[model samples]
Target: MPREIQKAYKNQTRSVDGKPGKKYWQNSVDYKINVKVFPETRIVEGSEIVNFINNSPDELSEIVIRLYYDVFKKGNKRDSRVNPKDIGEGVELKTIIVDGVNYDLANSDKIKRYGTNLTIRLREPLKSGQDLKIEFEWQQKVTLTLDRTGAKDDTSFFVGYWYPQVSVYDDIFGWDRLDYTLDTEFYNNLSNFDVNITVPDNFLVWATGTLENGEKVLPNNIYKKFLKAKESKEVIEVVNEKDLEGLKLKHNTWNFTAKEVTDFAFAMSDHYLWHAASVNVAGKDVLINSAFPKGKAEKHKKLTSIQQKVMKHFSEDVPGIPYPYPVFSTFIGLRYSGSGMEFPMMANNGGSGVPVTVHELFHMYFPMYVRINERRFAWMDEGWADFMENLVIHKFFNEDKSNSFYSRFKLVTQGTLGTIGDLPTVTSSQYTGDSYGYQAYSLPSLTYALLYQYLGEEKFFKCFNSYVKRWAKKSPTPYDFFNTFENVSGEDLSFFWEPWYFEMGYPDVGIKSFEEGKLIVEKVGYKPIPISIDVVYKNSKKSYSKIIDLSVWKNDNRTYAIPVPNHDQVESIVLNSDFPDFNETDNFFPPLKDSYEEKGVKSSIVGNYYVEDYNIELSIAKENEALVIYSNSWVWLNTILIPKDSVNFNTSDKTGVLKYLEDVSGRDEIELEYPKYNLKLKGIKK
Candidate 1:
């Protein structure tokens, strides 16, 4: 265990048995905010009243506030490039009142400012189990950069990270002072919010929580339909283009209230189509909504229905947990057409199709409900969401293997593993740079899916549901997750965890030999992966796949033998599956040369070929009077191939030999042999 985790145990904030310690506490703040938005000017002005409860045992001499929009401020450090048009003065503070004491803004001794964090020294030390009140007024120009929160156009905006809020004071990390670098996301406390947003009279708002006064702000007929859709299972067009055009402008304030949520966000648009539906999850009706521009209505018409199915599947099938929120909305006007960002009860979507919708909705369970700390361990949430999204796509949506999640997972895993920028799952997400997507999403998701396969559906979900239930509404470290699964499953999964989570390696297994009713498979890579083999029979001309679970490698055995039924009738054995493999060229047995021995070389062998086992590229051709072979792998360069006969070939040196093979695609292939080096490499003509 790391020293930090050991310290957390000694501090009594977390237990070693995968549960919260007796003295575990998380600080929270209740916010009352009033904000006004000007669409034409793209300005947002807000004032907030914060009631912070110090639930931790340590006295707080100082407090930290996160200003997320400071990434747009000129000269601030940023992880990635931002739109130049959005660069401006970040948040302008107008007034600050702490416990009714006025503070001077220009006094350097009272406050210190970092790139995106503000540290304020308190006048008096706040004792344990005490509380304080703070008030602030600020204004910021809404950015057009189309980040997680930004304006899609002059009249459409998805606003997040707009308010200056108190940072999380947790049991493990005291103050989450991580900068908002547009790289890592956020870590926040579950707090209560009562916000009143004042927008143009014609614009409509879709926010993070249930609208407390929807009847007062919305049209009378539309308000009735919104209420009716909450109880009905049918999808209703609550605010269509016609309703948006016909509504009279009267009230401008939209009131919203959300209790025990991580953060708040809202989207406003003058013209957008809204669809609504409801589904009963654990005896609670969850209102599902989708809003998009009229131009995207045709593409997003079935979004609410899809969300209904996802809600039901996620609640009843996978995690077996109830939906936590009463209302959920997806606003479809993000900058790009395929990006999506998740909040507590809302999503800023890019109007992509079903997969993005399902992927973003799955986040509601991981980081949102379970409160996974995205600033450090993003894979904890992103990996699970991607895994569940792919699982639902295959099981519920009936997508084919080509379009299935596993296909993409295999492709990406194979491409990324052992590459230059590849890192383990335990690495901090903010440091992974170009490989962040692979580390946070593909690799871990593949690991989870493989774990599911190894544990089977019943045992897998039993442990999975336990982890979710234990960490719901709380922050959990990676050790907490690792320990919970081990505790629930009653198994020490160090063998599985060490290689995939903490180590650097990829999975590569290949066919060694098949003889005497037994097949020997070799583990060429460091990571342990399940073996999937397909056996083709010559007599029956049929094939069946034999699956070996990942537990076969529990002992770190390099080779395993499988008893093949009717081995005498087996014509070819191939190591093939949806799982990732680094080198697939040698997966086919019987050495393509043996099958084509009866027929003479049908195609020319003068071309380049790749030998994956040696990581070598071989250029072979008839150079002058000798068949010269040039290799750029390992230590050797060139070798001479002399014709032994019309149909056979051998090198000038007696130790080297070669034979012809016909590829499945009718390309000419060869098996090059070096007896002195004990090397037999299969090379396909490219």
Candidate 2:
């Protein structure tokens, strides 16, 4: 542990018992916001009241607010590269009020806005356990650029990062003062919201919370269909294109309320179709919703069905918790992010694949439920999601597809068969520079999977669910997560977490030598992973596979010898893990080589021959020069027939060794190993 972490533990921000400290605290906020969007003008106007409670022990000096729309602020710093044409005029602040007092409209030294974050120095210090009400009225233009959140076409808009939120203040970091470079993900204090959005009457608003007043806003027939669709076993068409006939009302307000959420986001469009259905997960009937352009809805009609199945899988099979939120929604905003972005109870998506739907829905479990700090540790969220993705595939698809996908992850990650520049999961996501997906998504997920294999499914699930339950709705750092796993599993996982999470190398273990009834193995890489090997006996010729625990690596054993029973004549030995071996050349150990050979014909060395310790290339010769040749290897010898002319086989004509072997006896197999350093391999006659 680092000095800061130990200090935190001593300070009671975290506990030595692998749980959040008794004195741990987090601030809470309540938002009452009303926003009006002018889609034609590509602008949004909002007025909001934030009721913030200071739950910490310290007195506050300044409050940092994240005005996400200011990312488009001219000359703002960005972690992700974007085209200049995509930038907009930035957010405009029209009015600012603190605790019912109106400050100077233009030049208040207390108010400072830099980049996307605004820091306001308080005139009256907010005491501990006090509530402060801050108000703001602002407008910002939507950009032409498409990202996780933004406007899509002339008809659709996926609005996110549109409001100002108070940065998280925790025991570790006083305030998360980091700017929005869009590299690291977001971490916000759990908040409650009562929001109202007003748009053109033709537009259909699909948002974060349950639609509380659908009867007042939606068309009468559409409202009836929505109610019917709530419990419908299949998808119900709420509002199709034909429902756009009447044009009496000009505008309407849609009200929504959400409790105990990390953040809130919504999408609205003037020309999208609406679909809804419900499913029973965790003894709760959660509504599943979808909205998309009429042109694409036919192709994506089963989205609601996938959502229902995924919800049930996550609730009962894995984490074993019922769905937490009341409503789950999936809205279409294609060409925006090419994937879905998950909020508290909704997902903004551009996917038609089953894996994508399941993967995004799994997000609702990790950072949303467990509330891991993603900006610093994205692997905590992305890793868990990728791990669950394969599980879902196995259950819904097939075991073969799941296995194939699992291998694909291994190959792309550090476990690849060749040297790859990889980083540890403990490294910050923003500082990963490149290879972000492999670091955040593949490597960390592989850790959990390997952990699953280390501890069987029963123990693994118990420990994992314990961590989720303990940290629900709370912020946990990387140390807290690792400690919880060790505390729950009753295993010292530093040996595992050290090499897999805190360091950057992959595991490379192979058999060194096999003799008598013993097999010696060598650890070629820095990583000493748990071993699995298959041993063969010459007498029985049957292979026996066994997995060894990782405790053997505790003594720093470079070469580990495993004693085999009934082992006078050991046939061969091979190594394997659940993942893969980057190199297979050293994977096998042998007593397996035989020193003798069978009689066979040998040519005058038609291919390249060895002479005077040098390789000599030769051209094709006559028919007699090409003779039948048989060659192979073993601990002593496998089998071969040596002929009379083969040994002293016209060494005068063959001046050099064979550089490349084409074929022998109509077979492309040539096996030979040099006893000392140099030896000649004879080529067969044509």
Candidate 3:
């Protein structure tokens, strides 16, 4: 029997913290899982039994065990099956045994129910320093979906969180009672994991850790020998060749092992062709592996070459902390709904271009190696991931930082302008919807880009390394990240985070107008990011630039009309012409005409003129003046009367007055006016 605390003490403790304090119990978990696959049935049976070692000074009461069942199974019909569970074949609860005693599932306290996770109450609370063992058996039928584990193609499978696993109990949030949503990230403790996967005899496996039993597979003798090996042994042999033909299945069982991993997933396919290269990252040997179909093996080779280039580039940028694992595997299968996902030493990539592979692989350094609670603060993971990915792409591809990378940051920042009023990163619920790319991915990336601009490259990287080292394998909130930078750079950054993350506002710097040798700029919008204006103007035959100091206007909209000292020589002006400004449409001076307006003018109006009604009016000025006129109408003899002709004549036909002449000869000025004809004439002497 467990020792019970007095009601008075419990009430007193509850009053102090509003719940059980962190000192109530010590929680530590280690998992060992064995998974076997039947490729024909597309069914996977996973058995994971976790050992929870309690070390709290106080006696434990009820413990909650979470089975990530929602990742695999479908919920009931009453609950709309829109979750990952509803899409994939569901996993049934075969059994849940605790300490050799079977508990009644019907009467168990269901803590909370979402589509992906089910929480159950422990039968009896174990005391401090006590141990409890829980075993679960479930079958998963993998299907393709936007989240969770699923099949990408006939041969390659992308599996993750497909089994019932335990949730985390932390000092802060206790049980981490968050429903599995699209926007929310994941939080878990670092624990030891042992996984065993079985597939068709011919299939090759790529997993999270090192292969512990590579030498155990002898020709045609692995299966019989593997059965005799105990679970405690480090090596196991696998031999099953009934399915594969025309291929040697003699050495089959691929035994692997890893320590201190938060999650585990692997891909197996007979059709997968594999290639690997080893690189030294931070004095550690890291293997880079790629897998693709046989016909696309050459493409996989090219991808591996690019991967090496990216890995080397990241090492130079963010030095120290070498890759922990032996193998970094990238599986290229069919395109999934999700672009890319990062695991500890593995990443799933479905991008067609070179940048996608680099982006996904860089995650191994950011959130994967620097483990953070992704569910609570996705920006911490995704933002850093995107930032590092861009750095790698820019560095390796020799891309122009100001254009390709910074231009994209500007575009995404502009796109997310008005959406800041939607919700906070911690409170807003719309983060998981289709707009996730805009809010979660793009906005955070832009924020980092701005940070890079504010702190410079060296200080920004130093702050990044400090944050990664401090919060690795722990849950870090947005405050923790901000504080890390503040502490390292010795500068307060709350002002930066206020508008960038909390509020959705972006910088809108544009050229309001340029006239009379003055460059007028209008800085609109609220977000406080650095303003860089590139003033391009012509000086004589050459164009010169004067960079205006706009960084002072980060807070308020201030109009600046800077006078160009060389006004007479100025021809054209371009504001932020290099495309560094977030919005470039309003950056250019002498604004380009609208497409519709430009198309409206007649194409044949190059040399044509017309008057509403031709009434004969003539005027003459001094000598040496000449005039020329032409009329398409042949009935009227088109003639021009100049100031030099000193004579004037008028026709008196009344209705047929088609002729008029004026001759001033050498006179200084002469003017002719006809009141009856409703005509007036004026002339200038040259």
* Over 4 Å off, model 1: 335-337, 399-406, 539-541, 591-686
Q: Using Cα atoms with residue i matched to residue i, what is each candidate's TM-score against the true structure?
A: 0.86, 0.80, 0.72
Leading candidate by lDDT: 1
Query: What does candidate 3's lDDT look like per residue over 1-686, in tens digits?
Result: 00122332342321121223333332567788888877766677878888877754445455555445344344432222353434544566677777777655565363334555566665566777887788878776655554334576666676766667667665444566566643455566566777777776667777888766655542334334433332212222132232233544545666667676666777777766555556666766566667666666444557666766677677765534555566677777546423667777777776334667777777776666666666656766776777766666666575434333454454343433454333444433334454555556666776787777778878888888777776555545555567678878887676677766666555567778777777777877566544344333453455555544434564465777777666676544545432234444465444422311333422111122332234332222111221222233321222222211123322111111222222346422323343322344433223
Q: lDDT score, residue 91, model 3?
A: 61
Using lDDT as the yardstick, the better of models 2 and 3 is 2
Per-prediction CA RMSD (Å): 9.1, 11.7, 19.6
Give me candidate 3's TM-score against the actual structure: 0.72
lDDT of 2 by residue, 635-672 (tens): 11111112223343211111112222345555432323
Alpha-carbon lDDT of model 1? 0.81
Which ranges of candidate 3 are over 4 A from the true structure? 1-28, 54-89, 109-114, 126-131, 146-148, 181-185, 218-245, 319-321, 336-338, 399-404, 420-432, 512-520, 535-551, 554-570, 576-586, 592-686
Q: What is the lDDT of residue 510 in candidate 2?
A: 75
